[model samples]
Target chain A: MNDEAACVLFDSGHRACGGCAAAMAARLILDAAGKDTIVVSSTGCMEVFSTPYPETAWGVPWIHSLFENNSAVASGVVASLKKQGRKEKVIALGGDGATFDIGMLCLSGAFERGHDFTYICYDNEAYMNTGIQRSGATPYDASTTTSPAGSCSFGNSRPKKDLPMILAAHGAPYVATASIAYPPDFKKKVEKAVNTPGPCYIQVHAPCCTGWGFEGEKTVAIGKLAIETGLWVNYEMENGVVTKVKKVVRKPVDDYLVGQKRFRHLFKPKRNDAEIAKIQALADRNAVKFGIDITLKK
Target chain B: MAIGTGCTARPGKSRNNKTGSWRVFRPEFINEKCTSCGMCRIICPEGCIGENEEGLPVPDYDYCKGCGLCAEECPSEAIEMKKEEK
Candidate 1:
């Protein structure tokens, strides 16, 4: 493998469809973490794509457990390492399906217990691995297999569950949301979390090419647009207070919705601007609630 | 890859043509029936399919995961899928 290829976490022999953004996210993350990291991946795309019996692509100490217990297992690793006086960093990565929906309980328990690990949620907004099913992190008015948008209902009517808020409620030392589009910011967050004292949670926005119905190369662009439009906010809470904001002023969320097929249902003729507006309002609420420090472009 | 945005975002990852879990299948474009409409390239979810120097749609099989999405979404039935042995 060339030096450039060394950054990838998932390699050949895994079963990810063409244009898998989660795979890209996994690679970007591993690149940021460098080599001194042991990843505990929940039952999701990263685990499915990196480890398939005799043929494995993961270049680090990786473990694949049940869908909801990655955090618990990570806690175990942290405890064992602490007992052994090992200083290496441990990261637990999970998908939105695992993190926001099924694994939420275990994650909460891990955080509340103050495990010395960093839990990064590669949030693609749905269960992309299981045929594009809707998960708790899916945005409102976005169509999925479960939440079909039609004349009556636009899409997922219920807003995405506030995951970072929930993690913050656990009183964890650090809680932040990031996107793969912003590499510098993402890398910085990972470095910060690794160096920080207690448990840290970073929810990184990962766009799904097939599931979201966008061009594969636009994965990074779409992910960046998510944060730029405030559809997804990047912020961190330090010691229970929302102290640092990643991006201040957000673009209109429509730029993001138009790029994906999942939200295509809203672009019809007799359109539901109210639903779109409601989604924007939710983003605005996040800005206000989190007190984002918008940075003005010079 | 052309960088269209701020500061020319540096490219990441290896374009190493390693055939592992994912491999891109080359699209056999029938120039006779091809209307040059660009649907195959447009609908390519991977965006790895694009016009060559001759303006003919070509698939970058190195990154293509053989998803056959091009053949599935082809409008004119001009693109045929051929699976290559890894």
Candidate 2:
């Protein structure tokens, strides 16, 4: 394939932190979507970085709206384009903070209305742009600015709200969870979402560097580590049945947490082994719940 | 500009069976600025920093999270964060 055509979707001048996984995900999805794509971005890191006033990293038609209205805006774009007889592909992207939290109503409305668009959530697990605040996508027991571990608290007390399930419940034709760590699988999912009729949603696990308190260069490594540890799983749902895309087996949660300072408190002497165990159990439960082959036990 | 060792680069593969197989990014240390201090080793979340036989800091990339804590905390600006090759 021509890399130049793919390269034009997102320019290198965007302001995302060094090695931002969302940038990589945006690049890959827009590459697969090709040149005739129109992207509607929410008020998140991707939006702020890619379209900073005088400069825009997006090569295709791009729009930025309120934090929670990216989906609705894209739906409007799709409607306007349809009315104008424009067949160009339409995509809406937002972080989990926007999609699962602030923008839930708008997103749900768009999905329920069955907008002919693809809504991709770059799930970095928090509102990284506005200073690593907790969102609905933040995993339980993980510390965030909003959920700092303290004398009286155990980090975020609630499990990450299952977003793909919510989208599936909206009767979306396609919904999938992807990670930048697994590119081929993510590409396939993107292609599927683009081709599927009606509304589609793909939540990509884009590991953050600056917000996660790690070096910018570890984007790809952290991406893979996330999936290996089951904190982020590569899976898809069609008609509400979840299926794991077994590119690799699950790994220990500690293997994923050791790199980021956000989880540093967990590793300290107070040693919330129960919290860590809960996270591991969540992974195990997902494996069993979704038929993921642990591919271990030797 | 090559930051770290690339001998075991995975190319298209994902898993590496060998121990210390995960991509190792060697941190660049400016000896003139380093004071034989241990801050780089202390802030390392992965516990990958080690002292060489001579007591200089060395990053064990096999377990190093690539978090760059050493680079951030170096008071003397001695550690330059470099990515180890795959």
Candidate 3:
């Protein structure tokens, strides 16, 4: 391995699709967290792609548990490390399904206990590992396999669960949102999360080419659009206070929604202004909630 | 499958799988066009990009999956995607 490759903790191989943002997120997270860290990955695309039993990509110590028990497993790891007096960082990685839905109970319990660990949720917005099933973190009006838009229907009827706020409500010292579009910012947040001495949570918006239905190459662009359109806000909360947020001039939500095939139904046959307006309203609400809009003076 | 020490395997053993065969479009690094911004290196999903001397980016095609991310996200348009002959 070259010096550069030696520095990359998450080595290439295994099997993530071309242009997978989750894969990029995994690499960046490991890069920021460093080698003195143990990652507990829940069952998801990341877990499936990065580790295939005998062959694994991770250069650091890594483990995989059940789908909904990521935090529970991480809590156990943290306890064992403390008992041994070993100082290795523990990071629990989960997809949206594992973090936002099925594993919420375990995650809640872990946070309440205040384990000295960091939990990173690669929020691809759906269960990409299991054929694009709708998840709790699925944004409002996205066409998932379970929530396909059809006659008398607009995509997913519910909005994305405010997971960072929910975790922050548990009195976590640090909770933040991130995206693959901004690599340095995401890496900085990861570093912050690992250094913080509580159950810090960071939900990174990883655009899925297969699920979200965009060209593989456009993954980073799509992530950038999500932030610029105010659908996904990158903000940090420390002790339940908004410490920092990535502000944008703000583009119409349509620019972000128009490209993804999941939102194709919104444009075809006729432009569903009403549905698009509702989606736009959701972005507006996020902009207000996070104060992400930048007012250009003069 | 011989499982050792709680079914342990060598770290970074996934490197055995050459993923370059998956590429339909290959990125040709244009030295003249490249300003060595290193955007392709940081943004590569596979982490297959390496830095040569003088800080130029050289992608290890053995694992480059032809995601076109480097070309698409290139600030100076230094990397161009060409149809893979092989």
Candidate 4:
């Protein structure tokens, strides 16, 4: 689909935040899948906000399934299509909470069964739909409603789950990590996933303006910072083998974290260099693992 | 409208819910400074901006929620955000 047509598929009249990364990602995903696609969305912010009672923004055949069963629903749809000898593509959509936490079991089962579908997880880092609570996808030291930073506690103590790698381990035909900062790269990955056979998983680093505590206009900028800092590495794995990686221009993690209110505690009153360093180390490790050239140029 | 488990309205019913009232700041387009790059129209959250005969963006203020995204992403600074006079 072209740019103009893509915009029409995911109507902007829906109630998304001023600069919603998930909304943009949805448009890109649907555009890649084209009109002959069936979308299955899990119960989350995207589902609730897009399809309120007596209104819908989606222009395709969309279904709202339980939070933990969207993948199962997509699998069923794929199976039905195959039985009927149809060529319609099935795309399963879910937020980080649903994909990494609630719906992980069903997703794993679908992947194991080698279902012909694409599961896209919009990783906004927390359970924004449930009032910004901490989830398995929340990065380390990030503050959330459930993981508030206090005198003794330092927000969320654990790191983000390696979701794409886990999906790759399942021997998915295609697995990728994408960011909303790069629209062309994201669009290409979605299209590739849609056309690839068997189970494909694409995790998109979607930033939430309200939940992440960033200015509405800074949504795309924040997403770029995440990629540049190597905190959100972009890579693709095919059949359990790494095939592609987006090299980062290496920046300190502080540049990415200091913009969002969720990480405000790390800089105010007294700068927690130790915590910041730990996060930076995580970025460094990610760059190395993904073969991203982070070497600073003189 | 009765609340249900799924979407009940005919598709595209969201167009009926004019969200312009939600805006606290409105984006004013400066046609002279615009290069007709269409970046604002592409990044606009409302997708209410359209090009006129001159290729300058003309926003449908009745549905725009004053997101200011157009002003922020505008490469030429052709769009400026002005506080709405409630």
Per-prediction TM-score: 0.76, 0.76, 0.96, 0.93
Residue B25, candidate 1: Cα error in Å is 8.9
Docking class of 4: acceptable
lDDT of 2 at A213: 77
- By lDDT, the candidates rank as 3, 4, 2, 1
Identify the superior model by TM-score, candidate 2 or candidate 4: 4
User: Evaluated with lDDT, which candidate comes out highest?
Assistant: 3
Question: What do the candidate models score in CA lDDT, each in turn?
Answer: 0.74, 0.75, 0.92, 0.87
Candidate 1 wrongly placed segments (more than 4 Å): A1-5, A8-14, A290-298, B1-86
Residues A109-145 of candidate 1: C-alpha lDDT, one tens digit per residue? 9998999999999888888878888999898888998
Give a tens-digit lDDT track for model 2, residues B1-86.
Answer: 35467342322211121223433555678877888676554333333456766767776554444445467557798988666765
Candidate 2 wrong stretches, greater than 4 Å = A296-298, B1-86
Two-chain complex of model 3, DockQ on C-alpha atoms against the true structure: 0.64
The CAPRI category of model 2 is: incorrect
Give the Cα error of residue A233 in candidate 3, in Å.
Answer: 0.4
Task: In model 3, state the lDDT of residue A267.
Answer: 96
In the predicted model 4, the residue pairs found to clash are none
lDDT of 2: 0.75
Q: How many collisions per candidate? A: 5, 3, 0, 0
Candidate 4 per-residue C-alpha lDDT over A1-298 given as tens digits, one digit per residue, 9 for 90 to 100: 2556666677657787777778778877876789888999999989987777667777888999998999999999999999999999999999999999999999999999999999999999999988999999999999999999999878999999998889888889899999877777898999999999999999999999999898888877888899889898888998989898989778889899999999999999988999999999999898888878756769
- Give candidate 3 misplaced runs (Cα > 4 Å): A1-7, B1-12
DockQ of each: 0.06, 0.02, 0.64, 0.47
lDDT of 3 by residue, A74-187 (tens): 999999999999999999999999999999999999999999999999999999989999999998889999999999778899998888999999999999999999999999
Candidate 2, residue A180: the lDDT equals 75
Deviation in angstroms for B37 in model 2?
40
- How accurate locally is residue A174 in candidate 2, as Cα lDDT from 0 to 100? 88
